[model samples]
Target chain A: MVVGFAIVAAWELVTAAGVIGFRRPIYNALALVGNMLGLAVLFLMLNAQFLFAAQVIVYAGAVMVLFVFIIALMNPESDVTLGPARGSEWMYGIVFGLIFAALLGVLLVNQGLTGRSGPFTPEVINAVGNVQSVGTALYTTFLFPVEVTSVLLLIAAVGAVYLAMRRIR
Target chain B: MPVPAYTFLLLSGALFTMGAIGFLVRRNPLVVFMCIELMLNAVNLAFAAISRYLNSLDGVVFAFLVITVAAAEVVVGIAIIVQVYRAGRQMDVDGLDLMKE
Candidate 1:
């Protein structure tokens, strides 16, 4: 758990300090991949076995690899970095973000007082939540969601095909 | 001596927060996507804990569904990014002003 938290902290630090500028798309993509892997490992530690695998197979394996491919596809001559904002505009944006963060924090803390608060921690998560148990639950109680997800995946597949076709044309 | 549930909760919470911060602060689209994944993983941890406590796998099922959705989301996002890169000659979110920038 401590290690997981440390990784998360490092990710936060790396990106926030401008260590991951958009100038290097491929490197940024790779870093993102590492971050996703770390997250999935942390998920497994939390006992969400099925989710962790899906996170690895679907996200880290499939999605991230595709993202890297996109980076490869980009024309090398193109520059991706956005120029720094001038004057008060930068300050204004940061101020608003801070305000929003503060508001969200207040709302969450208040909600905790209502007794509807639940755990969102790592220790609470673990490997007991594996594929076998998840499937049993899905087939039994949450069959409705499973069906809905199938429909969603179908739509996404069709959409991808359509988009790819347009590109080919 | 014994592991407390709060330890997990706090760990996941801190990680999720870091992810959120990374996603927002970074201009890189890839980093942003990774941060979103981090946040999703955090939720998975929450599901896991509840499942363990109840000895019911409902939470795990939900987490799996979320992961599948995330998979679909990534596919679509990458396809879009590919197209964007091909046309704009730039992957920077700021510079790729579709019509003109």
Candidate 2:
């Protein structure tokens, strides 16, 4: 568990500090892939086996590949760096982040893992299986949203093709 | 024993803050997108932690939806970026103001 947290912390540090990504966006993209893999392990630790597999297959495999491909295609030799943030804008951002963190800490301390048991207990999942339970719930209770997601994906594909296509008279 | 839920929550908060800082500091549009992904992953961690703590599957399901939506959003966003790059040969977010007179 601590190892997982350590991985996230180190990865966040590398990306946040722009250490590896000062000149190359590909490094940051790869770091994101590593972070995604770590999150998959965390999903497994949480007993979200199906989510773990999905995170690996979808996020680590597909999404990161897409990101790396884009970064490479955009400008392989060009150095990509952002201008340093000017003035007190960053100070404000830091203050806001600290306030948000404090709020989360307070909420977590007061709640402290209080949760009601649902249908997908460990034994229930063992009996009906994780994939089946998720699929059942997705198709039955969340059917509309599932269909909407499919539509969203289709629209995204069409929109991407249209946007990236060369203009033709 | 597994890690405490509060630990996961705190970690989520920290990751989200880091992502926010990255988003603020980065000028490269691609890096900004990556920061957004980091924020999304942080939220996913929180959802999984809550689901595990509550013995409920709802949080996991929502996280799954978040992942799916993120995939779609990335497709559209990167396409727009590619289009802008092809048009201007510039990747800086500040230079993307095509409509400014």
What's the distance in Å from true for residue A71, model 1? 1.6
Residues A1-169, model 2: lDDT tens digits:
7777667656655644552245578877877787788778778878889899999998989998999999888763333343444556467667877888788878676856656667666777768888888888789888999899999999999998988776522
Residues forming the 10-long window of minimal summed lDDT in candidate 1 chain A: A112-121
Per-candidate interface DockQ score = 0.33, 0.58
lDDT on C-alpha atoms for all candidate structures: 0.60, 0.78
**Model 2: residue A107 alpha-carbon error in angstroms:** 3.8
List candidate 1 segments past 4 Å from native. A1-23, A75-80, A86-129, A167-169, B53-56, B95-101
Candidates in order, TM-scores: namely 0.69, 0.88
Over B1-101, each residue of candidate 1 has an lDDT whose tens digit, in order, gives 13345544544565466556656555556556656766776666666655555545566677788788887787676666666654554445545566663
Cα displacement (angstroms), candidate 1, residue A13, comes to 7.6
Top candidate on DockQ is 2
Please provide, for model 1 over A100-156, each residue's C-alpha lDDT reduced to its tens digit, 9 standing for 90 to 100.
Answer: 566556544553222233342334333333455556667878888889989988988
The whole-model C-alpha lDDT of candidate 2 against the native structure comes to 0.78
